[model samples]
Target: MERTEKETTYQETRRVQKGDFAAAGQISASYKNMLKRLGVDSKVVRRLAIASYEAEINLAIHTLGGSMTIIVYPDHIFLVVEDTGPGIADIALAMQEGYSTAPEEVRMLGFGAGMGLPNMKRCSDTFEITSELGSGTTIRMGFNLLN
Candidate 1:
């Protein structure tokens, strides 16, 4: 579901620049810290941390630019990640575990083992993704608080 900050009682958004390796994990780590401080369940925080880090890494390594947003609802936690351009050509294929389009150098860097989307989906209570070949990708994930 498409949502804005107004829909939530609490929200945090961070812009991710393309190829910003130096600042790669900082954004998601901040999200984890905020979630913990807000008294979110430890398990939920761990799942979001994993999913957010994956989304953050994908945006930093793949797209032109994007944002990572966290929205807190009464019974759920939501994440929205949106990117600029060069979106996935095949979302079905991309969702497959161990399937990656990463370059040789990126793989050599010990990242992009094709687990990002799969991990995000596995960790979230609900997940949706949209992508256009030349446009961009957006991923929405929800985690249930009662879980």
Candidate 2:
């Protein structure tokens, strides 16, 4: 394959602090901006924004703290969210709608009524989640840019 246009790609990592209202939507916004800057198709950008925000909110609200990294590539974007908080015991159950482990306070704030993982899956072309009882969790999502 001969060279064509100059490839534009980058990686960004940010720490998400639990219970930080000000920082809640920052990661998602950043991800969206990056995609927009890359001139990604509108459909891909929309889906990516939704998936990225859902994962980012899950990390900020459910975990004590965590990190999110976005890897931009030529044909796709990858997102990894890793947390050291209490791990989800049942991945299957967690994937179900309305099966939330969020506390009452979180609910009152209209944050976690489940739906995070499910939404992530719905938005991404590929999604995977892994967690251990006491070992925390990691959610990986990939959005394909080429249609």
Candidate 3:
């Protein structure tokens, strides 16, 4: 099931940089702040943080650049990330546990284990992704506080 969303709430936006590993953690922090301000508990906040961060880094490492948007409501938080990169040609394969298209340097840094999509799916109550081979990719992650 998807997180229940309200028509109005606090929102935040962040710009993700291409190949900027150093800035990878910023999205998670921003999500956490949004959650806190909305009076969400720490446990649920942590789950949302993990999912949001993974999605953010996936954009940074795989795509040229993108933006992360967080929407916080009373019941849950929603994260949307859009990137301009070579779309996943085989999404099914890319979702596998050990499949990744990350470069050798990224692998050496222990970043891409083919777990970004899986982790995002695991952490969010409802996850959605859409992409095209030559266009871009967009990921939507939702975490429910009621769970």
Candidate 4:
């Protein structure tokens, strides 16, 4: 059977800079505001907010820099976070709760508890991640509006 594909009706991309602690949550905040203005479901907004914030914090703390893209369709909200940095060597291990490789400084800031990826997955309707040891990592999360 052939499947039909839906076209994206809206999209936005935000750039994240390395170690930009001062601006860590800006992208997620902006998207949250936009979602609110667009009348997205509060539950969906809350899930996206949590996931987006986690992804943004990861980029700031782990990667050199990256961009996050938000795509909205009739059925779903999609988020793509890609970063240029040392990628995870063991995705399985990284996904475990309370297992973190964050440096001491980041831990001191109360940011790295090894829950980012797991939380994002938990909040998303769909989640996928790919990484290359010395290259980078990309994470994709989707929130279904129909849920």
Candidate 5:
């Protein structure tokens, strides 16, 4: 099944709280379930799950608060993550694998390996992140449903 980019559709939106380690990935899990229920392709679902989880974790672990929105079209799934926290000073540096500013405690908890942005970019068909020094960050990711 092939779909054109013009066939985009709005799906759902979810809010994420900061310092919610206990509930990390909850939004992605629910989004995955929703996609599954909609009969979306497994591969697309997998990619969305991975990307969404990474974005969610970044918000919880790094930001003060944020939200995740899922927009589904006939051909693709779009994810927009916006947060209100200390923004990335260097997006290029942040994108490097194994480069993280996560605190020691976060690393000890098995996260902040500097893979969040890289992993998100890897899993999405299109990915973009913008941040200010002290304001916050916003990430937009798109996953193709028709491969």
Candidate 6:
């Protein structure tokens, strides 16, 4: 059930640097702007914004580095994020709402409250995360364009 090129309406990719405070919300903001420009429904855009922001923060605060890409289809939107290294060991535990591996430094910044993954999952119609402890993590989230 993968989308073909002919079905994609638009796509964009952004690089995320680890601990890049200045670029923290750039990815999500860019995506949100694009959707708004495209006249996508507010509910879908809001869901995507929330999930993408959490995904962006997780990439910046948790991984060494990563890239996030968004693909827009007529009836669906897909987000694929891949990070460099220092991956998660337990996907199940990480999915827990209050569970987090973020350090005190990140928490002090008013983030890393252990809600990233859960928020992503909650906001998306489909969510999948795969991580290898020493390698990296990949998260794919899909949203339906109900509007």
Query: Against the true structure, what is each candidate's TM-score?
Result: 0.92, 0.90, 0.89, 0.93, 0.91, 0.95
Top-TM-score candidate index: 6
| Cα lDDT tens digits for candidate 6, 28-125 | 98899999999999899999999999989988888899999999999899999999889998889999989988889988888888888999999999
lDDT of 2: 0.83
Question: In model 4, where is the ten-residue run with the lowest total lDDT?
Answer: 1-10
Model 4: clashing residue pairs?
none
lDDT of 3 by residue, 1-147 (tens): 243445547777888988888789887887788677778988888888888878877877899898898877666677888888778888788778988888888888778888999888898888898889888888888878676
Listed per model in order, the count of residue pairs whose N, CA or C atoms clash below 3 Å is 0, 0, 0, 0, 0, 0
lDDT of 4 by residue, 1-147 (tens): 011345676788889999997799989999899999889999999999999999999999989999899998878889999998788899999999998888899888889999999999999999999999889999999899987
**Cα displacement (Å) at residue 39, model 1:** 0.9
Candidate 6, residue 137: the lDDT equals 95
What candidate 4 gets wrong by more than 4 Å, as runs, is 1-6
Better of 3 and 6 by lDDT: 6
> Which lDDT value does model 2 have at 11?
77
Q: How does residue 139 of candidate 2 score in lDDT?
A: 89
Tens digits of lDDT, candidate 5, 1-147: 144546756566777888888898888999989899989999889988998998888889999898998888877788999998789988999999999988988888889999989999999999989999788999999887777
Q: Candidates 3 and 5: which is better by TM-score?
A: 5
RMSD of each: 1.9, 3.7, 2.5, 2.5, 3.2, 1.2
Q: Which residues of candidate 6, in runs, are more than 4 Å off?
A: none
Candidate 2 lDDT by residue in tens digits, 1-147: 122335537777899988675578878887788778889898888888888887777877788788998877798788889998778989999999899988888778777888888989999898999998777899888888778
Runs off by more than 4 Å, candidate 3: 1-6
What CA RMSD would candidate 3 show?
A: 2.5
| Sliding window of 10 residues with minimal summed lDDT for model 2 | 1-10
